[model samples]
Target: MAKYVLRLFDDRIGVKAQGSLPAENRIIFIADGSATVSAGGGAATLAANSAFFSAAETTVTGGAEGAYVLRYELVSVPETEHGMLTGENIFSELLLNASMELEPGDGYLMRCDRVDLPPGGIAYTHTHQGGGIRCLLRGEFHVQTQGKEHVINPGEPWFEAGPDPVLAWAPDHKPGHFSRVMILPRALKGKSSISYVNAEDAGKPKLQRYTIFADEFIAI
Candidate 1:
């Protein structure tokens, strides 16, 4: 088995500026504006809300107006760089890091998706088959897990270790939306990752909707 760390980064590139992304298996999501990513002798333009994956060192050049992006990386060692801003007007923040183990010959998939909940919507107690990092994109929600509770707001990120029971709910007056990148079994590709912990909850009305952005098999 090989141990790995999954990290999420929030980045901003100034107009006409360029930045280098460390070589790793990574998924980059353009949150705002546009940018051009070059890797492996190829370049692609990523507009807002679009994402792409790269397994090698890559360079990103900001568009005429600059860009804001979220990057998720899987690496073999822990990262120590924590600088917030550099001279190039680039800003980077480390949001979350979780350790995991991968077995040889096992199939795995990397998925990025958005979940939306209407006002007062609730995701009853449930468990997932794999773990990943999630970032709240809009509104607010409350999470209960491991005997503790947390109120999550926009821009806040959290990690969910697979198999831990979780219960989340949005406020009665506001809706909640979030984006996440998860590492799951290849068998779950294009399928739901959630499983209700209680039988009764399974029969309840499910109020959350999902929008998948990227789902791809990953080499382990």
Candidate 2:
């Protein structure tokens, strides 16, 4: 099996700030304000709530109003530049770092998507075909997995190992939402990875919705 590390970073850039992201498979999400990202001989201006993917080294410049960016990347080794606050007006905080082991094969797919849960919605116990890192976007929820329970709040990140069963639910008073990036087998492209543990749950009502942002094939 080949080992990889999935990392999530929160970056704050000032109006005059600019920097380069290392050459790797990455998903860049614009959380607030805007940014201009150039990669692979192309440049695009991404507004808040939108995202894009890059497979090569990328240059990023904050917009006139600065920006709050979320970066998710896959690397062979864990990066040391975690909590860096540079005088150049760029600030970064590493939110999640998790290891993933995958069988060497043809190619893989990198998917970035958002999940929305209505108030009191519950995702029955289930497992996925691949692992991923999820960051809560709004409201609050609790996740039960591996005999442990965790309360996730906005801006917090968590990791889920694919084979381990997970059960998540949102509070009755408010809706919950989160965004995630997953590494999966190429065959799963445009497919859902979730599998309910109990066959009966498959017929239950599902109150969650999804929005796909980036789904690209990648070389291992």
Candidate 3:
């Protein structure tokens, strides 16, 4: 298998520039502003919450007012016949293989939102029922899944496997913010997207394993 490379890029442009993708495939998420990405005679204008895939060796040209992008260089993993059910990469702690199958004409539901936290804020442990990708827009965020942790900074991208338990925190020095694009099932149940691991964890101390933030909320 090939190794994956994750990178963060921030571009503030007054004029257009040339670009190219050298990895096998690169997934890009736009964090802010607007930009035009042209390749192979096709062009796409991207804004916040937008994402696109550029194949390897594609020559791209673009211009932007102000934009930050999170790029993931990914290699396709082998199929189940190869004997592996899950994998890990720089993008995520646990990349669990999707456990469900889609039927004919089935469609996926997408939920996009911006989640922000005050300085020294904490998000109680929780889980999402479907997979998603998140990109840090400002400050710093500490993401703990299961027991492993990863720090995500501005312009960086991270992944969520949906079923795994997760906790997010803001470092004491500054406020934190990020955007997410989640893929959920169309027939999903419930009025809320999140499933808190323990309702009791919500009232714990700030330094405890879980705690609630005063200004905590998600904008969908």
Candidate 4:
């Protein structure tokens, strides 16, 4: 089995850091209070609804005041940075497994999934292939993809498909914690072409985010 080094504070408290990973991955939230990040311009305050993304580098401070965050690096099974499904690093608290699809298909297709976390349970820094749809059945969190973030509260559906992963993010988990994502395998189509039908320019990733596909409003 995979074991986490447990290097940082897993509970609610406070911490500081030097901005690192670029491309929107780190997520900060107001747990019981709030927090602020001191940057080149000024300090950005994070309250209950105010969250921060850590895709790029930026100086950050106290999660005190009520702000807290979970690096997808820390919350996963173990070595989630590598992005492998069959490994000991995957967390049971946030279980991710592959189940055979119910319909016609050759081999096996797997979807990214999440179980339940504790009070402060969170999932962060994930990637989705082109033409991917992420569904948050229960719970609340911001879905960060394509260099932007979308606050996906309970009963919301988000879709994205591109040559590269659109990017995936969410706050944390509580009761009935779960998430379901459907992605078409590259092997299915053979070639490595990933694109959205609504792309304004060929190979350009769209920025107009929506909670439903086309016109389908997913229910909570």
Candidate 5:
């Protein structure tokens, strides 16, 4: 079975659509603008800095013209296959949109973590052992990765390739909060899944990092 499936929806103003999820634990990230998402007579608005899991099929109505949503269809791997499987891709279809690539992997362990920061808090420069997506929930965060800076506000989502060093900072006056899902490998399966890099070490060559193969990603 495939590890996960990803689809990007770019909806114009007044667009309404109905769709069903392949799995119950699908994740929906709002990359831009707002949308009214309803299912089974219940509805919620997801915009910048917001995300939610759908345990069933859902209907989505675009909030305005030119809005987009990133949908992740997550599937869990058997622990026996990967030593102990844990986290959760769309690679090609996303190429025209986001600046991320799906890493090579035979299978993946899906893990999600809720992160919170205090005013003036900094996550420091770090890297993940696996690739995944992050969604900002509240407050403000400044994320610098791969030499580009992104201000992740509420309802906005970002992706990391797991090997690149990243710097995240909360504003000096307020706090920051977000959640991330990591799609990691079972090799060295018991490791913490995260690595930290110091400012001074960032410029150094030959920093130790794992390898991800091109064959592991899905071809368009």
Candidate 6:
């Protein structure tokens, strides 16, 4: 399993996980703030623009403030099937493409595809079927799921399933925008998108769609 952590950078706003970089494959970079990461056999202090990869025997702890990190787990991305798109029109442009299985069985499994939405662009709800994670890379979307309505802004994500299937409308989704969602079977065992019961108090969601599926993602 690969662990994803967003060591708080700022007290208020969420500064992104630096991204769920990997421990084995992660860069272990301290972008803005400062922090201490356990390595080899002692503590190494990382400051802004400072990066290292010797935290094999250590864990990261916040200092006076916090640190932003981008983690990439070799076991997670390399083992699991993944596809990505970049630039203005990523999904629609088909920047990158791949296919995978959501479960052991072949049937009842969806293609697990990703597509981009242009401003005022609308993807039929039929395309939103199957279970996956949706991340608002940029801009916002009028997201309505399971009788609940809300706005998914940039740097935010949402998960959907049958019945209460999710629906997103860019009726107001801004431009130069991008969002990505990873589709997976909720039936899959192991680290899931299940949020902590006390996430609300913690002030951050359990899953980071664009990068990390969860702090501790399961492996096959």
Colliding residue pairs in candidate 3: none
Please give, for residues 1-220, the per-residue lDDT of candidate 3 as tens digits: 1322222233332234444544333445555555566544667877755666554344333345544444433333332122111212111122222223322233434445567787898888989876666667789999999789999887667778788899889999977787665545565522346777898975665442211111111111
The pairs that clash in candidate 1 are none
- Candidate 5, superposed: residue stretches over 4 Å from native: 1-19, 23-71, 74-106, 187-191, 199-220
Name the best candidate (by lDDT). 2
Give lDDT: candidate 5, residue 164. 88
lDDT of 3: 0.53
Off by over 4 Å in 4: 1-11, 15-25, 40-42, 73-220
* RMSD values, in order shown: 2.2, 1.9, 10.2, 15.5, 11.6, 15.8
TM-score of model 1 vs. true structure: 0.91
Q: How would you encode candidate 1's per-residue C-alpha lDDT over 1-220 as one tens digit per residue? A: 7787888888888987888765667888887899999877788999987888877778888888898888888776545444233439788888887898876454888899888999999999999999898888789989999999999998888999879999999999988888889989999989999999999999999999998888988876
lDDT of 5 by residue, 119-151 (tens): 787766888876777666678989998888999
Off by over 4 Å in 1: 78-87
lDDT of 6 by residue, 1-220 (tens): 2322211111111222111212332234444466666655666777754544431433555556555433222222344423111222112111222233333322221121223455775433333233444444456677665678887765454555433444456654363233233333444423333332233433532122222222222333
Q: For residues 124-143, could you state the per-residue lDDT of candidate 4 as single tens digits?
A: 33333423333344566554
Residue 105, model 3, lDDT: 32
- Candidate 5: 10-residue stretch with minimal lDDT: 83-92
Please report how far candidate 4 places residue 2 from its true position, in Å: 22
Give the Å error, residue 152, model 6.
0.9
Identify the runs in model 3 with alpha carbons over 4 angstroms from their true place: 1-14, 17-29, 36-66, 70-105, 188-191, 201-220
Worst 10 residues of 1 by lDDT: 78-87
Q: TM-score per candidate, in order? A: 0.91, 0.93, 0.55, 0.28, 0.51, 0.35
Question: TM-score: which is higher, 2 or 4?
Answer: 2
The candidate maximizing TM-score is 2
Question: Ten residues in a row with the worst lDDT in model 3?
Answer: 211-220
